[model samples]
Target chain A: MPLTINNYADGILHGVSFEVQRGENLIILGANGVGKTTLAKVLCGLLPSDAVNIGGMIPSQTYSEERAKRINYIPAKMEVFDSYLSVAEFLSLSHFNQTISIDEALSKLNILHLKTHSCQTLSSGESQLVLTASALLHSAVYTLFDEPTANLDPTRMKMLFELLKNDTTLPSKIIITHNLDLAYRLGFDVLYLKEGRVAFHGSSEAFFDQTHLDALYGSSVQKVNNHVVVAL
Target chain B: MKKLLLLTSLLLLAAAPFFGQIDLPLDKLLQSGTMEHQVFFELRLPRVLLAFLVGGILSLGGLVFQVVFRNPMSTPFTLGVASGATLFTAIAIIAGFSTFSPLFAFLGAMLTVIVLFAIAARFQNYDPTALLLVGIALSFFYSAALMVAFYLSTLQESYEIMRFTMGSLDVVGFNNIWLLGMVSGLLLGLVYHYRKAFQALLTSYEFAFLQGIHVKKLSYTLLFGVSVAVGVAVSMTGPIGFVGLIIPHILKTLYRVSADKLLWQSFFYGGIFLVLSDLIARNLGESDLPIGVVTSFVGAPFFIYLLLQRKS
Candidate 1:
């Protein structure tokens, strides 16, 4: 069954309805303070609500491993309470795919050298890679990544783009990002949120049209060589 | 450095039962026909064991509390469980039911746990800060209730309450020591079973939840187990402070390991730390100084030094 939210109303966002089927990735776009992160939390059952469902089960109501296997939400930043928890140890906590070891995931993210490093001591960009490594190891059916490229440099961002575009470990990826260029390149169906409402939900071809870009971002954004760019 | 610290800890534990106000000469005690034997076995041995077990309980409780609450300052006593016990003990003293003081203290601790869980259940989401605030409020209320107990008490009853609050390790026999040992074992067992879950929580609560841990249920169960064990300890030793707060931190600093790995180590070092504190309390003065004063005086400065060292 597809991930579904029917008339979900959190104080920050109201009358929200959406569904994301298996193997169908989606991008969530919204201006600052438009409740993108809040929606991700509600969808992942971090904030319990009766308005969301996945695989015929309400996410917040189902406490079993089945619910966990269905969805995972990766926040914008990695948060760890223990100072001495190594990156490897943290990844091991989410290691559900037996075939892909912690070492493999770290290597895939180019963070194998950081395997022994304490999670608390990692730089922000390094932490972003570590979080990506964990997502690979988690292998949940539906994974929602919030600002996955926020801290990455160009090289790491490209690596993440490849993973997001082709990785089959996780069946569905709901990416929430402010990077319009990356959003355009990913070519996933877009769900643009504005002022706690769905302003646009359609294919990338339609959402990235010059008129639509002009309407949404006005003179601040432009289309250059089929790539979304800032007007500067 | 690790080996050195372990050696020092062992040496202290060995030397503890020997040095006290009334020294028990080994030769006389070995003869088995003197007051030294009785003193060594009945008073000294039992007291040291009592202090160790209580320290272990408090220290393990501290580690669990800090991890579960995600606040470094959270200790077993932070949630007012000990304050509840202290208040109830004072009430027992003033109400002339001193013999049932332990029962009253346990009841008070359990009551606080129930109240905390009740409040937590009403929230739509788990909020550690809100729960911590509730605990602080409960502590303030208990402190006020204790003041009322003092106001209504006779001078002798007030003195008794004061003595209990100061904390002591004056058990006379092996029976109570055995009981504390069992309690320590139970606490250790409970934490050990949940060690992996606790490690998961060392990450954020949201991360832990995604890992399929019933974060709320696991936390509540661990908290309840710790509260019961700590309540038993407080009823016996009357709220020994700082041991719970400092020992886990000390071990974390010394070992430089995550708390889940230091679970047993925290308990061991916590026991040893208290034994050392009690040793100082016994030998430093003519009359026995209250154990609580010694722990703070010794623990606070050393803790500050460690913090500074880590900062630099």
Candidate 2:
């Protein structure tokens, strides 16, 4: 397990105990304002001020400085550093002695043409890709991507999941996503959140079961052929 | 890299004394120690040097403030620290307060910052925008107090207050230069030692924490550096307005770089810009003018242009 919570007596995630295996991809599913993002923040150390309201050991005591580097997150709104430097320059400045060349990162993401582009000049789509490349620049352990599917093409979604699986070095990953459609393709396990509580910890196959699917979204579902549609 | 730039700056500064309406030859000036050279050294050189030094200090201080606050408009004035210094300076001029009140100005600047910081502490979430708003209010309050002080003062002192409020750099002799040099060296050293912390500030606290930077300590360090820079600057030049505000803003927008790159760049460019501007201020007309007027005349319009550019 890459993460373990002790004596977590918060409201929603209260006494919640879950272990994620190495190289595992977990999808957090919940509507807006539920504890999905909060959990993500806590885990990645972007926790809000009243983090104790959710209960657990506080950040200063719970995690040491070195252990903190284990999680890298892409926040909801990425910070845009306005400078003359290009995308390459920004990544180089991020805590790395020998940074990977911009081309190497871009080629890995199949976006090598974006090597010379200024980050400020990129579209949201292209900028998100630059952010992704930056995340992988150092082979960072336990990369946490918040809503990776947002602003991404279908093939890129498939590419991201494949990339997660390809790292045989056993780096745990957490993806905070609401797009259940991508669950089958990207989700290894699903943490269903309902009203700030982790309601279920199971597989995507549960989405295929009519009873469980209905129970998953807490509504009725109809199975037309192989596809299950929820009437939420 | 900085050394090379420092050398170039020195050469240009030394050459400054030789170029003017009444040019002094190199050999003749050195042998006789001409009155013009002494005038240049005493009347012009020190003022220009102090302007450069203070400009560098202010720009560095402003750069750090904007970055830590993560807002483009954040500055010592925007944060109310400038008003703190200004309040005391006004008291010195208008209320028969002692002229040897730079220490009072320093305490005032820090105290005002501490007050705003304490109030902002209630937000606890580090809502920088809200803190920025609080700072603006504090500035308005202090500025109002200054105007009231003006209302109560004698006419001569009131005019002196007004002139000083606009910022003047007309001091003479070696003692003032030495004091400025000592403070600049101290502040510059502090800034460099915390270079990495400055970089950490540019990112989110989580990122900074993950990178092992103590955000709380860094925040205090930033406040200290800013107060020193603004406090000393306002004391020396009597609230030099735009050097702190405009230099860092123009530099950051132009460089489009990280806080670390822009931090040092702002210092160098600010020093160069202020020295050149002060030289012009000293000899632009028949009589000398306050350094702040030249800066504001140029900076205010340029600032407007920047806002327009940001708009469309």
Per-candidate clashes come to: 0, 5
Global lDDT of each candidate: 0.90, 0.68
Determine which window of 10 residues in candidate 2 chain A has minimal summed lDDT.
A48-57
* Candidate 2 C-alpha lDDT tens digits along A8-90: 44555555456565566677777787767667666655553333221233444333445444556665454554444466655
Cα lDDT of model 1 by residue, A152-180, tens digit:
99999999998888888888999999999
Report iRMS (Å) of candidate 2: 3.5
Report the C-alpha lDDT of model 2 over B1-312, residue by residue, as the tens digit.
556766876776666545545666666555547786676667666877787778887777777777777676666677777787878777876656656566667777878878976886677554666877888898899989988988888888787777777777776876778887887778777878888667656655665655546676677677666776677777777777777778887765665566677766777777876786677776678776777888888789998899788679
Please name the candidate that would achieve the greatest lDDT relative to the true structure: 1
Residue B26 Cα positional deviation in candidate 1, in Å, after optimal superposition: 3.1
The positional error of residue A196 in candidate 1, measured at the CA in angstroms, is 2.5
The parts of candidate 2 lying over 4 Å away from their true place are A6-17, A21-24, A48-65, A83-85, A93-103, A138-141, A218-232, B1-12, B18-28, B31-34, B117-123, B203-210, B252-256, B303-312
Candidate 1 residue pairs that clash:
none
DockQ of 1: 0.78
lDDT tens digits, residue span B1-312, model 1? 988888998888877888887877779987776999988888888988898899999999999999999999999998899899989999888888999988898888889988988998998777878888999999999999999999999999999999988999988899888888998999999999988888998998989999888898998899889998998899888889999899989888888888899988889899999999999999888888999999999999999999999999
